[model samples]
Target: MTVNPLATPLSLPARPELTGGRPLGVLLLHGFSGSPASMKPWAHALAERGYAVEVPLLPGHGTRWQDLNKVAWTDWYAEADGALDRLRASTEAVVVGALSMGGSVALRLAEERGSDVAGLVLVNPFVSSTRTELKALPVLKRVVPSLKGVVNDIKKPGQDEVGYPRLPLRGLAAVLEMWQSVVPDLPKVTQPLLYFRSSVDHVIDPSSSPTVLGAVSSRDVEERILADSFHVATLDNDAPRIFEESAEFVARVTAS
Candidate 1:
């Protein structure tokens, strides 16, 4: 349960060099079983561009996976949603940036908050799983608390995700439920979208991109393929592109 320094939350205020026309804030969310460490660098990049940024350490994460096993997906969403609310208080508009399971939380926020959410930047996002075994998770989790983790799927050497070493089954089942809820409201996500997908990702499957691109009602949607990266594209070889382009997206969307 020893906390890694990178796992801590990050909060930065808007600076004089702000990118957009108005005060804009961004809330970045990390994936399941993962810590804020995965998104810290990305948060700093946005903060440097003069955007208010918040990277919350989602509940039941950044600690032992056993704690993750005790919480549901709702807990994660609550943390993300609260962060968005807090950011909105000081900014004219907000953008949600997410990786993996964090994407689900972002989509739900957009679906519910509508115009308040200025845009979205998703990297290797996941909303559903084709893995057949998940159907039994509701029952299986009663017996098993966790499995080995699926973290640090980066092609870049020396990259570390700092995620929990185990996969929490209770949380996994709850996230699947969140996916179910988000998918149905995809049409409500009308904000501009910047979607980044890793062509060689090992954690995310092929279905997520199509599901989001096909269902979202957003008129401004851009899909970028990370051909050289894996699941954790934020820390992968193409990470600079993700950071740079996302800042650009934030600027374009927040500009009035």
Candidate 2:
């Protein structure tokens, strides 16, 4: 059988739309080494429910992994922050949802934006890693260019996340930097939080969720365990739960 070209490791189109009904906007972020394809289903689910949604392709992402190494953590965060700004400008309130490293970026946005962000929905956010290799990232990033990839961690078959097949060391370093930067400010995220974690994940260490739950100052924080999914849970079996619960969370938080 012939393969679809878009299914290959190539840059995909960015997904962004403004649903003209609700004054509430949702900014959905995909994971590191991933494109908007991962978040597209969730974005559409929220949009159909009358919420404005923006799923931007992060800088240096959705393209070649080599390109990801050329950029820094700040670049990725800046892109997400800009998207949040545009969403906030059009809507009265904004809720940020992210997967993996995308969740780290969301927390950073919540910390910096303060009360501007209405709520947060995170799926297996990467905060810190216990990997011994990570300790050498600073030096390895300068010597090594890339390593084994950590993409397409979904358990569902015939599904594609359109992520890079190789992990760029510089990009990995940037992700580590983002984690370190966001960890300290976790307490600053006072917005309501909805965290979704897969029961079994090979990509991210399981310690991430507990660290977030313990650090965040949000009193309305809630956690849902994805019994049948992996790290990229957005494209897995429990996706509907994430989409529905996030929409409901946004409604409850943004209600005036």
Candidate 3:
């Protein structure tokens, strides 16, 4: 499959820093169907702060919806976990910044990797769905390979999320299954968390924030409201706020 240029992975070494002699690191992850394009701006911001940054294109994405359908949730997690390992190899500490499904994968990384993940910066993270249709995904996916498009939920005019034009049912089911494993291990996510939630999101269900905030054992959890964005908050009007605040969050947490 021919991947779009926007889908290319980003790997930047942190600039020389005197803070602790070793530069810190960050792993930014995009949402379902979406590619690294959604994360570039934010990753650049952190990289500018002398932090090593990586934005890896997830498996089954940036090509076609049919490709995503054949992927399992485990594949996404493995890629994220590997990126985290790579970042840790050079930096003194690490923070994970994620959007939508990437947030779900981030949670699992925190759970399994423990304190190696210094902190979390999540934007419009997706967890459980209240949609009644999802309950029938097992049967529904077998009947149909896809549904309408779930990409480009940004309210910013002329913005293209550059994700699959259609939603793959089998792929959707795979991500939802990840919630089962993550939710149960939420208590293991004790890292300081900076969560960005869109007040007017069209793609993510309202139930998502509550499920995560209610279970994470983090003692330094802060939830900020994105008043002018949607599910793809990284590409929305409130993107600047996410970039600025998340950088601060990473600096503060990694310093501690």
Candidate 4:
């Protein structure tokens, strides 16, 4: 579980900023094996509109995938939880936005924080997988360190997510373990939610979106289907819609 300090150079740093204008803040989280880079553009989009934004680089991510193997789900969730605390300290209210596994963390935050979290915006979230192969992770991780890469599922040619090229089995198991614990508590996420699902996602299964939508207690839930993006829609063709619509959603939900 100890990380090599030399691996830090492989990933980018966390993004944090304070806009003196509004009391509203936005917390953005990246996906598993991914860094804050995935959420950077979205954070910028929100920041340009004068909202404070904090996009944290999760533990063991943004570096070598091997680093992720050293940390568990609690470590990752703790990073997001800490970010929420920091955001809440400086702003009147906070909204959370995430992509992929980040969405799972955001859901957990909303569930635990209650009225402290103003709203949620998620893109291509992953909760559980019906894939039989993944079920073997409980044992496979003991022998295999990693499998193939799951990053850069973008349709945009030549574009890359800069995430780990290899998927750490231990890390993947930690995420799935978190999913198992979070799924049943989905009903506690009563905050206003905006969920984006990609029609042709190769990474996440089709059932994830419906499972979340069906379980969450949020009466103010909206689902948007992305016709032209993959798992990393934030950096894909439909990115503009994601950015613009999320900004609008934040305004709508946080309006006075």
Candidate 5:
């Protein structure tokens, strides 16, 4: 139930070309209750490798969880859509890399936008929520908007940090709704998918494993388990490996 609104809006750099032979474009999305700050290193690495990267700050995020109560899943999706459009304006094809809930958005975008997206990199995405967790959210959202600042303590990507301490219950509700909304459409995702699963993650449901692999229509599916990381694999001990695999995936997608 930890969901704190982002305090101040954060701005992400847009459409900077990698000074090589027209490197492909990459769009990155951070997880719920997270911000672009978490994905900066990954984006910078891609940028260094001659790939243009766009990591947008999701709406109601990077500011505060209270604002998140007013925002819906659509708002977050639109942000990612905007980032993808930015990538499209500069490159021939776009690759999407998303962490946690961000992964769901990336998959949905690929499903909806089709050939516009080249591939997907998913890190601990939430396709489904456990029943008990779902039932408790509404009460938590109302009784405790900021759950004692626990939500704020999450790990950020570029910083040695955990987010706010309170869990923004209303913010989490929106995320749960988003998960339910997108689960059915997973079969529509036809692009290549690279899943970076965290062996130690306790947040996402165990059901995610077979469901994701079975539902995705992608012909090229690669699943890598992070042996030493938690839910935030992008910033954990296995981060370097995640970067390498993601870079390789982007290269393959661009070449094809």
Candidate 6:
């Protein structure tokens, strides 16, 4: 019996497209406080397109709350970077795809990888924000911990209600640290970039799109808008198009 690596205990409702053959190796990064489960479909699509997709569970993710509290930005980046490095070791060209905060890590990887990185596909990349709440008290971040395992009524996916109930303060601090580290280096990101923005994202500020558009030096940058989805567009109604466009972007960049 040939062991199918994609077959996890998640018993992910089999999407035929996910199985078949592999083409290019793609590193798929999920959003902050998100699990690799969200990127599963997109991975399947990319795999069906003959691409090998790697969706890594970032450190401090997909597990308990205290585990997340212990890790920092470097841990997350190292996990993502390790996945990319593994993909690069086996493939000629690697395309980095990320959602939200994951996009930040992916962009940083592209900048560091330079010519070796083929392109970038970013979904709702959180750049700078004018949101008064986050700016007002950066100190509040240190005091708060994730409310994930608490609030017994919280929905933990596959529930009737869908939303991220807990906001981890320490995690946000690490994210801010990462943003500060990456902002100055944004202009050096010359890899082809495809940025997808959600018009209705409540978690992300509307200003983020322009920040990314102006910051990234990618000569072939393209921006597309998702009208029906909120922050987690990858799992929303507009997901299929996002997957298609992303795969197409990678194909174009690698070919050129």
- What TM-score, over all chains together, does every model reach? 0.96, 0.91, 0.97, 0.92, 0.86, 0.84
As a TM-score, model 6 comes out at 0.84
* lDDT per residue (tens digit) for residues 178-209 in model 1: 88789999999899999999999788787999
Question: What is the C-alpha lDDT profile of model 6 across 91-196, one tens digit per residue?
Answer: 6677888888888888778878797678889988875678677763367756666544211121224321112347676776678788888888889899888988
Which candidate comes out best when scored by TM-score?
Answer: 3
Worst 10 residues of 6 by lDDT: 7-16
lDDT of 4 at 232: 96
lDDT value, residue 178 of candidate 6 = 84
lDDT, model 1: 0.89
Off by over 4 Å in 2: 1-21
How displaced is residue 159 in candidate 6, in Å? 8.4
Clashes of 1: 0
- Residue 167 CA displacement from its true place in model 6, Å: 1.1
Residue 122's lDDT in candidate 6: 90
Better of 1 and 6 by TM-score: 1
Best by lDDT: 3
After superposing candidate 1 on the true structure, give the runs of residues whose Cα lies further than 4 Å from its correct spot. none
What is the C-alpha lDDT profile of model 2 across 1-256, one tens digit per residue? 2222443222122223333335678898888888888888888888777777888778877668888898888898898888888887777788899999999999999999998899999999998877786888899889999998988898989778888999999988898888878999899999999999999999988889888999999999999999999999999989998889888898899887
lDDT of the candidates, in the order given: 0.89, 0.84, 0.89, 0.84, 0.74, 0.71
What TM-score does prediction 1 earn?
0.96
